[model samples]
Target: MTGTHPVGTRAPGPAGQWLRNLTTPPRGAGEPPVRLLCFPHAAGGASAFRPWRGLLPPECDLWAVQYPGHEDRVGEPPATDLTRTARQAAIAAQWLADRPYLVFGHSMGALLAYETCRRLDHLGVTVPDRLFVSGSPPPHRVAAAPADTDSVPHRMHGYEHRTGTETGAGPDNEQHDEQYDDLAAKTLSADLRMLAGYRPGPAWRVPWPVTVIRAAQDPDLDAAAAAAWQDYAVDDVTLATVSGDHFVCFTRPHDTVRLITGAVRR
Candidate 1:
């Protein structure tokens, strides 16, 4: 864990302010050897990863990406363009390029992380040392749902009814949280629309190591879908499975931390 300067207390410069606004540093007192930038799934915010700070290795620092329209940035409008969001995230993460860093994203966030890497590559910026994608299939393999389909929150509510359960329930419950407010629902719909319309170019390849993590019983992503991630990696691709459904990061935090640390240490 690495210490964060007091919020709003960074030096007077664009770069300093960017760091202050976009990233939440680890809680310890010194900079760690490597940085891990964690991106959240649709309708999720940086606070979703708050538990990880204590579980990750001390040598690694955790920085969660705070997208607009969620958590403390709730007043800002959510981004609907995947390319533009990726470009902005790449630029915001540029400050971490001075050190070895890896990018970790779950579900929709996996796609976002991949696109950010591509944007960084296009800008000749330092590419991530590794990319860890959890519970998402390769970009090309993802089937586009109709852009006007039921939004994630609506789908989540339906799942809740079917299961006769409440939001934020345990491992046996549906992976999605059904407690989203109106604003979250609207933001998630926009993100889903972007995801539905996104189609990666054929020549694109992640020129670094990739580790694909799958939830053992994830309904949304099966073994074949998880394995398809190899198609987008130019280097080695390791597939690992953990216990739980799509929200394993929340349901199996210890296992998630172990898997992540193992991948980072390798």
Candidate 2:
């Protein structure tokens, strides 16, 4: 009853309403469409997947998951716990009902997406038809991040690879503004803390097929690590390496979409 619509069609409200609205998937004219819900990487928003709409087949209903502490939801604090975050996502995605759907995520988003799928299983909600985890090590493979927060700002700065508006900067070098820096610092640290604290094990089981994707040039990803997805998926498992770095999904949208759409078609 209180959640914001993915496409701005409805205003968000309280918990009950939020849960109700969040479950619904955005509709397009047609028979029941296969929905593809995408989660963005850390410090990313739903807008990251907006361009994918054009690349997928008409049969696929593309939905992008939005996280707080970024973009329009800057006022809201980011949730750090995987369960809490996944619970909210499942509630919001409930609107899609029982239609066949796919879940795809990149980097930190990948772990979040997988955990959300697990949460859906716990709630006895319909599971996604497929899961595509890109540019991320398997949940169980990722160890806790070092307990250090002092260098978070420097890490954020480096992770950004840019200092301009496209990098979430405001005009006139607004990132230099004390307020923006403070906000960014807080949110960034909180997100990294969440990432660092995440713990996973082989006990998790996914009944559906899973596709693991990596970038050929991603130094952060080890091919051996990518291969570990085989331990989790109950059905088929696939490994694909495309040209680019860890953020290649956004960097190489054309190829990324090709990989995604191709997987969907299969």
Candidate 3:
């Protein structure tokens, strides 16, 4: 079922605002042939995919999920349960289920995207055409990292520095650190705790194709790890390698966009 409503048409009032908050604005002019629902890494928000709009095909609209306790939703409390978060996301995105769309997630976001697909299936909504998992291993293979070992602020600092270097924004410093730390620390801590406790149940194969994107320089995930995604996909499972590390979504936007568009077109 394709989306019959034209682009920019949405319900009015508080309900509209709530749905709008979960998605990024469409960068395309007309109704897109497909929608790309993007999910960010841990401690990251929809803004992480803001740079992707310019690189994507004009026929493909990008909608980045804005989880609670981040970005514009900063006023809300962080979610502690992955199942609850995925359920909420599935509900928020139900309006777009009739449209041809795909889900793209990086790292922690990959898990969320997959879980959300499951919820959509249970709710009898249209599942995505494909599931793109980047910079993450399969659910069963994922083991929680040691908790509270890394400071939220410090991680944010490093992320900012890496992003700056990749975008030619120059070197990040104490100033940037101070600015984002307070806004992100508490929320990030809560997110980390949530992540630590998450353990995927026995394999439940998805009915759609799964595309795994591996970063060549990403120390955390290798080819073998990415290949494990096959266990979760009953359909085709393809692995594509790109340059850069875990932050390849930001650093290699063009390549990332190319891979995504290619998958959709196929």
TM-score of each: 0.79, 0.79, 0.83
Best TM-score among the predictions, by candidate number: 3
Model 3 Cα lDDT, one tens digit per residue, 1-266: 00111222232343242233222453433554677888778777666776786777766766777677765566677789877888888887786666688889888888889888888888989888888999888776765445443553464557666665222233545444443555556667777777777877667788888889998987667999998888898976989999986787786688888888886642
Worst-scoring 10-residue span by lDDT in model 3: 1-10
What's the number of clashes in each of the models? 1, 12, 0
| Residues 1-266 of candidate 2: C-alpha lDDT, one tens digit per residue | 00122332332443222221121345655687777778877666665565566677767777777676664566577777865787787777776546877888887788888888887888888877778999878776665435445643554455444323233454456544666556656666777778887877445778988888888987657798888888878766888888877776764577877766775643
TM-score between model 3 and native: 0.83
Task: Kindly report which residue pairs in candidate 1 clash with one another.
Answer: 3-28
Model 1, stretches more than 4 Å misplaced? 1-32, 143-151, 154-180
TM-score of decoy 1: 0.79
Candidate 2 least-lDDT 10 residues = 14-23
Candidate 1 per-residue lDDT, tens place, 1-65, comes to 01111332222344342233222353444664677887778766665665676787767777767
lDDT of 1 at 43: 66
RMSD of 2: 4.9
